[model samples]
Target chain A: MKKIFFSFVMSFVAPMLFSQSYKPVQVNFKPMFGSQELVLNDSVYTFNLKDSVYIETLKFYISGIELLCKNKMVWKENNSYHLINLSEENTLHLMLQVPKNIHFEHIKFYLGIDSGMNTSGAQGGDLDPTKGMFWTWQSGYINFKLEGKSNACATRKHEFMLHLGGYLYPYNTIQTIVLPMPAKTSAIIVIDIKTFLSAIDLSKQHHIMSPGNNAFLLSQIVAKSFSPWIAPSKK
Target chain B: MDSTFQKISIIFFLLVLLTAFVWVEETAFKIPDNWPKPKYDFTKNPLSENKIELGRILFYDPILSKDSSISCSSCHLQYTAFTHMDHALSHGIGDSMGTRNAPALMNLAWHSNFMWDGAINHLDVQSLAPISHPDEMGENIVSVVYKLNRNKKYRHLFAASYHLSSITGEQVLKSISQFMLTLVSSHSKYDSVMRKQSLFTNQEKNGYALFQKNCSSCHTEPLFSNFQFVNNGLALDPDLRDYGRMKISGDAKDSLKFKIPSLRNIEFSSPYMHDGRFKTLNQVLNHYTKGIQKNNTLAKELETPIILSANEKVDLIAFLITLTDRQFLFNPAYGFPK
Candidate 1:
């Protein structure tokens, strides 16, 4: 059903804008709550009739971007690791260099860093251990970090810290995300955080700070929450 | 023999010798004569004199701590095999006592895991553990880099080592690793005895045989450790409540298991065990022989009872003393940079 919806929108949204045209790919990720852009800190949001939440931090890694045309890979970014930070507006957008005169029907990217970069010693730039994403206790990147306060949370100051990451076997939480592209040169991806928050009972499972079955399961749900931005008129 | 061929061969040999000299000068680290191939991959961050010097400075500098009150050398003193012998538990910033003993630092290039529980897999990334530990340095890597960048001497040192004005965690970690990989402790009298340059006394020889029969399975020869995690049947310290490997691995079977530390400089690296319960070598020997706290997760090597007479224990202690390398303890290069 989701594949049908993507193909249906594939025809209705974008009209083969490539036509062998050379252009740089621009991706802008939007973090959104239900029907509104997700604002950090100052804004109060009420959900589940009892939960009042405010996101203090939202950071995740987007890596291994690949553009596909007709279910075949056409372009892949090299050294493609980007840490999308809500606080840093510039970090949420990426400018990828695509091959000249190529058409891509869909866009695919990893929601977290892969096992290769995780095991390979200390890295520079976005993957640097100094970036606060890497785990000091263990050798792995914290693929996704969402820290905030919720009224439903019973802990001190009503805080919840979810640091999801694992590269080792049986607990590797890296997730692959694929979205249908609807533009020629630019794409706006929406990570509907509402879908994520609604899926889990944040009160009972608020603190998932390590790699385990909880992190692995939560990572999959978070991956499914990402989608290509659809026009309000079309929606 | 053709005179022309012989002349060409001599020239070629001289050229080879010159190349060897240049190559050796490029890298300061080398795998010892008969040691196992190092687990650390040097191709990623090759050794250099400037980087090692920078790393040594970082090792001794208190700038890495939150309040600049502690450095790595605080817990790991060079004279005592790079580990504090006085304290059983490592004390860090704010005089906070840590949960475990700070193990001796030596031959790090061959270590597969760092920390008592084998939490860190790579040596290059091992410094992150202590630098960020609240009880240890109480400083994050980002904050440390910020501190390093602000210091003029560190900036110059970093530039000299990496040829980059901007300091990153990778450079800091790789430089520290370069210095640690140079800590090769293979000059002990036991090593000399193995090389036939020296001979063990009759009592020492008897102790060696006993060590081989009883302890060598885990504390293997040459490196004096297989570097495998095993439960050495240490009874749980109720006050500390530390379960070594199980805390990291999250497996019931791994409970009470800890990495078999190398006995390279066992004489100076006293207050042994993960929690440093035993103060002297005699206490350790007593634990192995009579105090084995038989548990379901206990090491199989300890299943058999080890019986040592009073004289035999003395001989074993004598042999253990031969494992200490004064050169390593007193090496000026590894001491305060100045």
Candidate 2:
């Protein structure tokens, strides 16, 4: 009779214990140029004051993700580096494991690759050298890439290329972004590219291939463009 | 009971022997006596015999190039102290030319930066520059990996080296780095004299003293290079107009600055300077004495004329020759894989 009672208790207790440990949370990144959702390679979006600019490629790295509750650390992702390529639809969603029953108020992440990973030698996956995000002339990785056509640009095809990255002092381009999370389980982070490129005049300074003051200023603008939106069901 | 005990003892002894063999292999990469600690962090990519051999093969293979006509060895020959002997500037595939001269390859594990411009900060990714340069190999790393995957021999080599079934760009770069790390040139006649194993001639001794006074500040001891970018006051060439480190940093103060090449194997690595403007040691010495063009960013040491008699110049050249390590230049271990 004692053994039978113990088995009944174990069956109920095991699942409860498992459920309390951790839960998988899906974080979706939705790229937007203003209110219009971006459809990669299909959507023709216009930006800048005159709305004569359009982007052909926009890709960047987001890393060092951490969850906070009341300014206290709750959970952090391991090897959290991710490359968000708008052209590839599957890369938009990221799965994160968070502690169960914890109220996460904010999500913090980096806009570019961290300095630690930059110095470390060739890595696999999204950080691989073959990803075309690496610089051949220099040893550092290109943190962010924005290439597109702009009528303001006087160059051939009216195109501009901005590849930003530098880890060293006085020119560090890494930007930290923090978004308030209303829902603990899941949220959609919106990146508005139009707002990010509002300040720059493409005609005067169309190309920024290496890291410097221009890259740092641009990355700062990008960091401010992300905002979290909670779905009604999750709220 | 006795038979069982004997079997257990034999098994234990075999295990001990196997462990020792593994330990020996892991500790094969040695640090030379009195040398500074290596800048390369070896924990990330552990050294092994198989990886080094694979790297040597890759170093000599022209398959890394676009048309399979140029290899790393084309510019870096073993006999000329791993530098192109005749060319003022490095020539690439299709007879295309590069802006700067190809620097010598030796004691690279100690370097914190690569290239004449100091553009590359690490050795592992240094090969990517030449491989992707339009005038150089003109091959992308992705295509290189694809080509390496299709080749049967590389497939076998990658498997043997990395114990993986497929080839990767990371593995290819790391293996090449392992081979380069083995190139530690600490057996020169100067090294022998420092170790008390040999004595320098009177001419060499005099030159050594002269070198200590004039050049040692930039071309530091032991490594023979300070490895810092400085403006040595070479006038800009109208055709090339290469600004060196300033091009990378965009700082006007760093204009015309270039990495100081190591004086080791100075006898063979000519023409000299970033542009290889001087074909002889005499020309380099003459420039130091008279050809220093005054500029805002010129090295302060070279501001005043370097005073040296004709005999003193010959003595300095003799001392520089002592830095040539015959063992390193002709080491079969570093030569083409047979």
Candidate 3:
């Protein structure tokens, strides 16, 4: 009985003690609007004579993060789900624990919550239903949410909303993003909101607020808008 | 040496105390004879007495509504098999009405999908729909959680059940699910006859035979539902024009198809149908006999009209009345918490 008792205690305490041996890797996310850092509601970006947008709410899930070396698996974050909200400063950065001497050349992650987690019952932390990313009338996470005002829209106050998510077959909007980068203690990735907006025909798809074909297509465009942050100089 | 001996004795006493606390906490949920295992994964959120009690309180509390004027019980009263007695379409706060009848809450753990359209995929998250619907509670889960956090009684109850200081959306939804999952109705006369504990009347026997021939394919026995979405040939109401499953699936073939509800406790749970169009058992039987509106999406069994003599219809209703579990309807355990 004493042996069983000690083993049970060790099971939980062992993980907490073991994980501290690894070095912490910082992954920073920089939300960009065209050539500048995107401000919540104060900044406006104009794409054309009739198209201008000011983002009011921007939030999405970054999940299932993995690091690869020589096209092979190296390290993976356990329970890796992050809800990145533009309005919250601290949430924009993720600290990943990695082995001190582990080698990696690529960082890969999913742009939304995976299908398994979608069907699984209530989740906590970043995947909490109270976070406003979950659909109330249905059962799936809103992978990408963007609420803003656009000049192209004719609705009340010219506002637009796009909530992209679907876990079922044929309409699964979860996208995988893999990028080649040098391994370091810290790295920055830019989410270019301007590129995503320009790629869309604003007049037609200004209000894709549900999971469907439009959300699936728009999710592909969202995937292409991401890139490693470049340092601009000599302007 | 004396101190070491004392420490071991104290540890043993603490372990005994913990065991007693757990022993008194959980009330075992037993599966009835010859019933299929429940689809709900109880291991994830195991049932406990305190959790179920907390859930019962939340189920009756009107704080979940927008104006604090209605609750889950407003539409689903316990005596009437947890369904609104006379309201055709469900009523909400501020005198607003919903588009469909409020579905009865019984034998829920057997169901994988919820709603007339199967919009809700899981039982744990099903509360989100009515809570946020414009015509129903008209309240969001975020606001509900915020309200729960501020309430002293709810917070104290939550802490007892989950042992968490702060209440969360997951805890709130899971606690409600625990209560709903416990509402199992298995002690009906139909079940007693099936188990050979009682003999069915000759009229009920004839009705059972007729039901198996015409209705058992869809409203299968044991659970009394195949749990499929089908077009039962009710013509669309032009004002509401609900396309049912097609709205969620976006498939043309799934148009006008709604989930087949279980017939358990059918005697008390009325008016019938998704829109609550049928007022009595006769109206519903007559619809199947003569009122089918033929469409491409109609059920295969309904392609041939069910011919029932007037006397046979009475016998069929007599058998249906045998499905009412008086114990389940009157169980104080499922009633308002003290």
Find the candidate with the highest lDDT and give its number.
Answer: 3
Tens-place lDDT per residue, model 3, B218-293, is 9998999999999999999998999999999989999999999999999999999999999899999999999999
Per-residue lDDT tens digits for candidate 1, residues B170-251, read: 9999888888888889999998998889999999999998899889999987889999989998899999888888887778
* Cα shift from native, residue A166, model 2 (Å): 2.1
- Residue B181 of candidate 3: its Cα lDDT? 92
- Per-residue error (Å), model 2, residue B154: 1.4
The C-alpha local distance difference test score for the whole of candidate 3 amounts to: 0.91
CA-lDDT, candidates in order:
0.89, 0.86, 0.91
- Ten-residue stretch with the least lDDT total in model 3 chain B: B18-27
Candidate 2 docking class: acceptable
Strongest candidate by TM-score: 3
Clashing pairs in 3: none
**DockQ of all predictions against the true structure, Cα-based:** 0.34, 0.35, 0.66
lDDT of 3 by residue, A1-235 (tens): 4545688999999888767678888999899987888888897888755578899999999999999999887999999999999999999999998888788998999999998888877878888899999887878999999889998888889888999998887899999998876848877889998899889877788888778899999999999988888788776
What is the model-wide C-alpha lDDT for candidate 2? 0.86
Give the distance in Å from residue B289's predicted Cα in candidate 1 to where it truly belongs. Answer: 0.5
- Give the higher-TM-score candidate: 1 or 3: 3
